[model samples]
Target: MINLINISKSYGENHAVRSFDLTIETAETTVLIGPSGCGKSTILRTIIGLISPDTGKVNIEGEALSTANLVSLRQKMGYVIQEGGLFPNLSAEGNVFLMARYLGWDKDRIEERIDELCELTKFPKDALNRYPIQISGGQRQRLSLMRALMLDPNILLLDEPLGALDPLIRSELQQDLKEIFSTLGKTVVMVTHDMGEAAFFGDKIVLIKDGQIIQEGNISDLIKTPSNPFVTTFINAQRNHLEIIGDI
Candidate 1:
């Protein structure tokens, strides 16, 4: 489980994340959703140790995230960000095996694991030698997933993982990702602005506005009993999107 207790982050005069609190249970997928500047990604970064909150505690499983434990803590988590975040110069296999090599895993073991991840993410082994720029958006994203899962971390964090793909590709990857998540059963926390995606992926949807979570529940709760007018508006916006995309 991951816990963010009273977390807050500030940039100059702007408060990016304000006194936010969220708990992500083990083996469950939790999604953070809100508008563009609403701080969903900020919260995710904090969890991944990419950004340290000015205030509050981050506890992962039984260990609290601190300066001394940050490195090891991060090693136990996998993170995937927007645009695949792959190295444009490196081959897909190189990117996936990067961490394992750094950790001193033998060549044969690395090859074995890379093979497993390629199959798991449905990435073609033939394309493993291709650079990020050489692959399609969907394939690049698949490589990113393979890289993240390469370490076999206990938790996974994603920030708008499918936001860059075409509609058809996005829809296909979303279904595949959910199946992978279920098969692995690792705790996951993802950020996205799409409500339909949230409903499809999240066991619990945490709706945020201006850095604070305004409501947390499933789709039924949000549609039936919104906590405020803002929540209603947000849901309506996504419902409109769903009308365009058809339900996920």
Candidate 2:
């Protein structure tokens, strides 16, 4: 499990996140949803130790995330960023095997792991040899996911993983991602502004506004029991009512 307590971050005088607190349970998928600049991405980065919070603490599986343990802690969490973030110079297989090689896994084990991940992610066999630039955006994103999972991390952090894809591809990959997460049973935290995506993929939805959590709960609970006018307005703006009421 990942836990954040009173987490906050700032740049010069501008605060990016303020007194944020969240708990992501093991083997569950949590989605963070809000308008732009609500600090959703910042929360993911802070949890991964990429961005240091000015205040509060982060704990992963009961271990505090400190400078001394950041490297080891990060090795246990898979992170996928927007646009796939694959290295253009590396082949898909190379990208997936990079971390395992760095961790001193033998050649035979790395090859086995690569083949397993390719099968698990359902990428074409030929895709293993192709560079990121040579693959479609959706394929690249899958490759990115494969690379993150190569190390077999216990947690996954995805920051707008499908934000760059076309709607059709986004929808397709969303299903693929959901299936993979369900099969793997790894804890996942995803950040997105797309409310439909949030409702579809998240077991728990956290709504943020101006760097604060306005509300959080199951999708049904939030839709049926909005806490205030702002929550209602935000939900309406996202077309959540369509999801709640179903199309006529």
Candidate 3:
């Protein structure tokens, strides 16, 4: 459903992504996992058109992304950035419907979509009027997911969607999010540092370092048949944490 061909992005001397090539299958969840500053998030942003690659191309479905079709192609994607990225001034409902309203959706259509999202994300109808700051971190994330899905985009891009929440809340949301993903079956690409989270949500995991993929496969593939030493080291580094939940 999505492809990045020979993509490269650099900032001064630091290379954020380098010759990265990936194909995200339709209706499947692909997780990008790496340490901080390792460029997984950069790849996600590039796919969403927030960062234009200095080399290569981003293809959505079949069309090549260009300045002319950036906006139109972007409408086919739903992006949820870190910490929800909700507008502080807007109520939860407002944030969710922001894009819809901008696209000139009618009041009835907006309200109907809002209700569906609230139920899908398990968000309370009563809290729709609340602002981002007024809600709990988990609720805020749910609202963020709602906002992303409001347009019913074909692809969902999430960067550390649950990173800001406490562990208990994160666990709860993970379960909820897994169910939501299964229910919707949208093509999903997400970035995270946690191996457990990646294993839980990812149908395919791409482990990256220094802006390049060290290994890309299922969790068992990385664990039982590592591509290199770094792949083993990366897994062992999180072994204890992963064992705590018996997730690895």
Off by over 4 Å in 1: 241-248
TM-score of each: 0.96, 0.95, 0.96
Over the stretch 1-248, how does candidate 3's per-residue lDDT look in tens digits?
A: 99999999999999999999999999999999999999999999988899999999999999999999999988899999779999999999989999999999999999999989988999999999998999998999999999989999999999999988998999999999999999999999999999999999999999999999999999999999998999988888887654657873
Whole-model lDDT per candidate: 0.92, 0.91, 0.93
Model with the higher TM-score, candidate 2 or 3: 3
**Residue ranges of candidate 2 with Cα displaced over 4 Å:** 240-248
Q: Which prediction has the highest TM-score against the true structure?
A: 3
95-158, model 1: which lDDT tens digit per residue? 9998899999999999999888887889999999988888999999899999999889999999
TM-score of 1: 0.96
The global Cα lDDT (0 to 1) of model 2 is 0.91
Deviation (Å) of 108 in candidate 2? 1.5
Task: Spell out the clash pairs found in candidate 1.
Answer: none
